[model samples]
Target: MQTCKILQDISALQVLSINISRRCFYTTTTTSPLPWLFVGLGNPGEKYQGTRHNVGFDMIDVLAKSHGISMDRVHCKAIFGQGLISDVPVFLAKPQTYMNLSGESAGPLAAYYKLPLSRIVAFFDDMNLPCGVLRLQDKGGNGRHKGVRSLIHHFRGNSEFARLRIGIGRPPGQMDPKAFLLQKFNATARERIDVGLQEGVGALKLLASRGLTESARCFNKEQKYKHIRVQTLET
Candidate 1:
């Protein structure tokens, strides 16, 4: 599995307003009234597929599948595709650079589209929460995530972006963070993730068609699955 880590925390509240790139690509096809750039944050390559940290990629895959779009090509140093949800143009991207350089790919893409960070939403994993949970925030701190840090850097200190954090839970016992994120989810974890991915796609649909505030209010902090423990008395 592919693994990487970032060494700093970036607060979205401290974004700057400069260095915006000048490139824009328009989708002639009409899908939705609002156009957005959706970025799925994760390392690139086949080895990382199915890992807990790749949940962002997984969510994008789920959304593309639902829209009958295939993410099978490279563009802007990432895999990307275009599709419309409720007449809104959505550019889906999976950064080619490893997680730490995710912003390098995303920043240019957003700037090229003439879109503000506000229209750009990133999906990524969060270790502070329990597995199978999802959080949607209009704007906030990066929580020390490498990909988000890089993105903030690329934006030159812009924090108006939307972020969707999927919980992968804390590492087991004292397992290394790198190792834990690289590990595949167990059967139960996969089931929970599958359902969560579906929910994530629905949230994306809402975010693209509706608005961030509406989408966050509807799906943020909502869990698609619940964990129930069964105990048996000693016999």
Candidate 2:
């Protein structure tokens, strides 16, 4: 009788251990949804406003206004705001660490939020693309953009973060690229950029509601075909 009682107690203990193990497995495998981080790269200061290089900053402003995300706080070396888009939490940041050192702000924001690279999207100017054109890409090399280079460096060499590349076009003949970047767009280009910003807001909303892949597929296709027509007209 004593041996039988001991066996029954042992069996109970084993069952309890199995239940605990199952709970642990469930806790480890299940995760809540993570927020998205949208970072705009540009130099901060009144002087840089409206310049080609500051399009990223302009984009942030447009997004904040459209979504009612108040960028009224300074955090992680950036002008920061948080709000919901389609009930999904989203963070918007404009790095105040200047363009080349954007990572100083971006890296800490990601770490603080414990976000993966896939959940982060950066907005910045791209000279390789024609003015008024935009590109959304999941991952790529920095393409010699200083702000992007800094981000890659701070991400521990990880370059998998998505980007919304706003085109400002290349410098015209014999003009210094640096000089052009700091120049305000002429009237024609300014009109194009304004139109582009509105379009960008739509694309971003789609991104938040649907997802990166779907948003990119729809946005990029329209932009590609539209730009092709524009180029043909100019030529």
Candidate 3:
């Protein structure tokens, strides 16, 4: 009887091993594509429309219009839209939680989608670059931007997600930074921003078609060259 008991235990172990192997196989063979989440950080409402701080929202609008994606859904505290770009699934969001609390919307949307941090990209304004200049980086800390700081906090201090910085330039000569952000662009600035938005759309299309790394590499190189020329001309 003892010998029979030992044999039964061995048989159970074999069954468990088979089940584990099958589970591994299933996991390894699954090939469903994960969608990319593109979040634009900005304050909601018409009060902030066309302000320097709302350029991120402008980007989302341009992208939606270009792709025919309707921004009619509210999800995770954001105006959300989803569509296919070159057969790649894409989700666009403009956080309605305002600029400072943008994470309240972005973080939950990422969690709800179950996307890896690598597949998430945020667009927001930056004062460090020249007006209408843009930069795309894989990951970085918040560059004194409250919206970015909030996102970092909600991401549990994980700054591994991607971001595209839309430059609004530094506040002019002692001008209050906050006031500068809320101000509408002048005609010249508006023209530059419009051009920047068009370039941004092209970069995003490349991102959807190729990927973050390749898109960032190509886009940043062109932007850097353009920036150098602008600086040379200014000086």
Report the error of model 3 at residue 12, Å.
25
Clashing pairs in 2: none
How far out, in Å, is residue 118 in model 3?
A: 0.5
Q: How would you encode candidate 3's per-residue C-alpha lDDT over 1-235 as one tens digit per residue?
A: 9999999999999998888666551233346356789899898888999999999999999988999999999999999999877767889999999999999999999888778899998999999888878998999999889999998899988999999899888898999999999999999888888888889999998998898899999999988987887677657
lDDT of 2 by residue, 1-235 (tens): 9999999999999998888766551233335346789999999898999999999999999989988999999999999999877766789999999999999999999998788999999999999877888988899999999999999999999999999999998999999999999999999999888888889988888888898999999999989987897688668
Per-residue alpha-carbon lDDT of model 1 for 106-193, expressed as tens digits? 9888877678778888999998756777878888777899889998999998777988888887887988999999999999878878
Question: What TM-score would each prediction reach against the true structure?
Answer: 0.81, 0.86, 0.86
State in Å the error of residue 171, model 1: 0.7
Error of 2 at 150 (Å): 0.2
TM-score of 1: 0.81
Q: Which has the higher lDDT value, candidate number 1 or candidate number 3?
A: 3
> How displaced is residue 67 in candidate 1, in Å?
0.8
* Deviation of model 3 at 15, angstroms: 24
**What C-alpha lDDT, on a 0 to 100 scale, does residue 230 get in candidate 2?**
64
